[model samples]
Target: MAMITWITDDGRHRQAEVNDGSNLMLAATFEDVPGIDGDCGGCLSCATCHVVVDAAWAERVGGPGDHETVLLDTTASPRQPHSRLSCQIISRPELDGLVLHVPAEAW
Candidate 1:
């Protein structure tokens, strides 16, 4: 299992233990973490599961795929260079302590 932490815009922190290979969106949803709506479940259709991957972990987590990148472009919040749709980020042993910061809102 891997531990994923989510820091909200209001400074609220939520953590969850997810099995390796679990999508970050499902991890947050399973933990009932706020700020990540994940309205489309693990699908890339909705940008509600948007999150800002901590820059330090960017290399490990990797960048979004074509589909995720397109969905991110529809987000209302200011998209950062590290912006990613959580659904596209699958947990792994390599991401044991991945940290994601939830944006103020999801669209």
Candidate 2:
């Protein structure tokens, strides 16, 4: 399992052990992490799972794809340089200790 840490906009933090191959949205939802609505489930249709990869893990996590980028533009929060759609981030052993910052709102 990979240890994923989620940091909320208000500075709250929660960590969960997520199985490898699971996407970030699934991990967060499974653990009931606050600030991640994931309104559209894992579909790429919505930006409710928007998050910003921590700067320390940005390169390792990479950025969003073209389609995801389009959806991110519609997020309730302003998109940042490290913005990403959690549904699009597939977890792996290599991302064992990934850290993500949840926006204040995702809709």
Candidate 3:
């Protein structure tokens, strides 16, 4: 299983384990972490699951696609260069251990 660590705006940390094919949003939702709402059930329609991946993992994760980029524009939090909509990210064997941080809010 892949491990995903979540850091809150105020410096709180929460971690979730992802199965080989699990996406970051689903893993976070399953773990009941506070920041990710995942209201669209991993459909990528909502930006509630927005997160900022750690800089070290940024290149490994890559940037969002056009569709995901558009959605990130609607996020409640201010968009950043490293912003990502967690729902669009699918965890694979290669992403065995990923760490993401939640922004202050998600609209």
Candidate 4:
């Protein structure tokens, strides 16, 4: 399992041990991480699970896909250089300790 950290806009940090191959949006909801509302349930249809990968871990996490890129633009938070949809990010051993900043709003 990979240890993922989600930092809220107000500076709250929530960590969870996510199984390999599991998308972050599902894991975040299971762990009760605030600010991640997975409204579309990882269907890549909603932007509620938007997150800004920590700069230090952005490269390892890589970039979003074509459809996901467009969805990022609709996120409640303005897209950042490292912005990504949590549902598009899968957990893996290489991603241990990954950090994702959760915006205050997930509309």
Task: Specify the highest-TM-score model's number.
Answer: 4
Instruction: Judging by lDDT, tell me the better candidate of 2 and 3.
Output: 2
The backbone clash count of each candidate, in order, is 0, 0, 1, 0
Q: Where does the lowest 10-residue lDDT sum fall in candidate 3?
A: 89-98
Model 1 per-residue lDDT tens digits across residues 11-83: 9999888888788888888898887788888767879888999999999889988887888899868789999
After superposition, candidate 1 runs with Cα above 4 Å error: none
Model 3 over residues 49-72: C-alpha lDDT tens digits? Answer: 999988888998999999999998
| Candidate 4 ranges with C-alpha deviation above 4 Å | none
Predicted structure 2, TM vs. truth: 0.95
| Model 1 residue 36 lDDT score | 79
Q: Rank the candidates by lDDT, best first.
A: 4, 2, 1, 3
What residue pairs clash in candidate 1, if any at all? none
TM-score ranking from best candidate downward: 4, 2, 1, 3
| Root-mean-square deviation per candidate | 0.9, 0.9, 1.1, 0.6
lDDT of 2 by residue, 1-107 (tens): 78999999789889998887889998888888887878888889978898999899999998888899898889999999999999889988888899999988866
lDDT of 3: 0.86
lDDT of 4 by residue, 1-107 (tens): 99999999999999999999999999999988888889889999999999999999999999999999989889987899999999999999999999999987877
